[model samples]
Target: MARNGRSERGATIIDVARRAGVSAMTVSRVINGRSSVRPETRAAVERAIEALAYTPNTAARSLVRSAELRIGIIYSNPSAAFMSEFLTGIYEEASSTGARLVLLKGEGGRPPAQAALKRFRKSALSGVILAPPLGETRSVLSAVRSWELPVAAIGAYDVDGVACVRIDDRSAAFEMTRHLLDLGHRKIGFVLGNPDQTASAERMAGFYAAIREVGGVEVKVAQGDFSYASGLVAGEQLLGGDERPTAIFASNDDMAAAIVSVAHRRHLDVPSELTVAGFDDTSAAVTLWPPLTTVHQPLRRLAAEALAAVTAAASAGSTVATCRAKILDHSIVKRESLAAPLGGADARSDPDA
Candidate 1:
């Protein structure tokens, strides 16, 4: 309602511009979070926005700038569950804002940014969200940097000029490892994530740090590509060994679920014969036979936040480098899959030595 006391249905951007004594275009820029707006002018527009209680109409905004607000997501990740949750977040946010999201991928496993660039050139997308492996690729990042559109990468590792939204993968893995250690499991086998992503190294470092802190723990390691199949292979190697570990920690839920399946095939009772834990508490974590004791990573929230940054940059005519990272918290989620070693079997020697 107007301060002059006539009945008002809603305040519009034109009303805000009139109140702020600026052009409608300038008000639009301010409303969109553009970096180019002068300080005093921005403040004036903000004040007018607050005074008039103006809220941009989503329908009208979409009608006006639909062509300029297209978003692209480039990914080369192998996890189906992770991608489903990620895309859900992006779609929810994009739909709310009347923005469109376009899925893109590399051809013949080429650099993702190359495919992204082609899509951008063809349709002039406003920005892009790059998922893991693709997000961490140096060539892909460099290619994206050559364009004017903003880029937001998902995961803890940062690119030179891209905004990121992620949980601390290393710390989360450390917490999970420490949990297993505290549970009296010393002979622990570690399954690594995909080597192409920096997160693999970070998670491995965290696991090693925990082992080092608690001296004299025997450790076995296996490599995985963050897939169920790779986990099956890694599981066979670790479990088929002469001296199997009391517990296994896989880098992701899919891999850990595979470990559980392998245990079943070997007639080993989970948490009785072996304990397994995983990272990323995706749906597979809960759906597993015993449910997974894993790190609770907020995948959907990470995606939503990443998309928010990308959209903000698109609307504001700003680069992603100007936006700061949005780092989120993670925690260890305990389930039936983890427990103390049975009857002191394969337990560490000397309780407090």
Candidate 2:
């Protein structure tokens, strides 16, 4: 009798088990690279697998391994919009890896580092992924060291012994600033990012570098915390001044959107009376009436890469002692929010101009 389509495809675990004179579970364990199976049983299963041409589904095999491995993610960033995208990336990769992700919540009244340590110690986490602010702190890295587990830092500064995956914040910021300068924007205003995160400092440095490169320009800066609320305050401060800038470059999209709102209330037409640009081409950038001109940071891909690094390190155990860093590229996305200042920024030096 001819075989059906399903059976004709290839040999299944059941066939391999029968050939090896073992149960399906035993064959599965052998196929999944489990170390607990008896040597003789494993040998028999291997012979059966080879003879029957049995091939395991890669995803199913990952699922089997994941059933045993658990990973933890620690974060302290205050931006809800940013964190949402960040977490989604981690979760997707974890699922693909066949590993369970444990979100380690606060423990005791201690800081994020201590809380992460407590939760990590209590759980069976094979590895840890540290998000910004938390990842940038030396104390947190020290705490992570005590655990001796594989550690990966995403969107954090490169440390000596921890794997890191990030985009060049300084370079991205530099390009965005240069883009604004190219559009005849000299008196450009800036809104700062979160002070606790290292990326904030890098971004500020980039902005300054761009300003120095074009010495004949004027610049103003307002402190912001990478939140919509902080952006609003920063926007008011920058726009309310008598020597207001013709262009504003916020460190993040939320703040840039807030600047647009401020410009609207002030009866200034965006890109005509004022031009705005931001970093992190996040969702809020496009949702605005006039889409923002910004830098595209691949946050999701960065998280996925970070998770892969940590998981690989975890699986490798002590053999992988050295830290590794992966730097991804970013691009400047032009949109309706930016344009050459009316006439020229130098020509509109007067506050009302």
Query: For candidate 2, lDDT tens digit of each residue in 194-312?
Result: 88778999999999988787656788899998888899999999999898998999999989999999999999999888999988788888888799999998889888777766665
Please, what is the TM-score per model? 0.80, 0.76
Residue 138: error of model 2 in Å? Answer: 3.5
Candidate 1 TM-score versus the reference: 0.80
Give the per-residue lDDT of model 1 (tens digit) for 146-198: 77678888984756677777888888888889888888888899999988878
Weakest ten-residue segment in model 2 by summed lDDT? 313-322
Best by TM-score: 1
> Which candidate gets the maximum lDDT versus the true structure?
1
Where does candidate 1 stray beyond 4 Å? 1-68, 107-120, 321-323, 344-346
- Candidate 1 lDDT for residue 143: 72
True-structure lDDT of candidate 1: 0.80
Q: Residue 271 of model 2: what lDDT?
A: 84
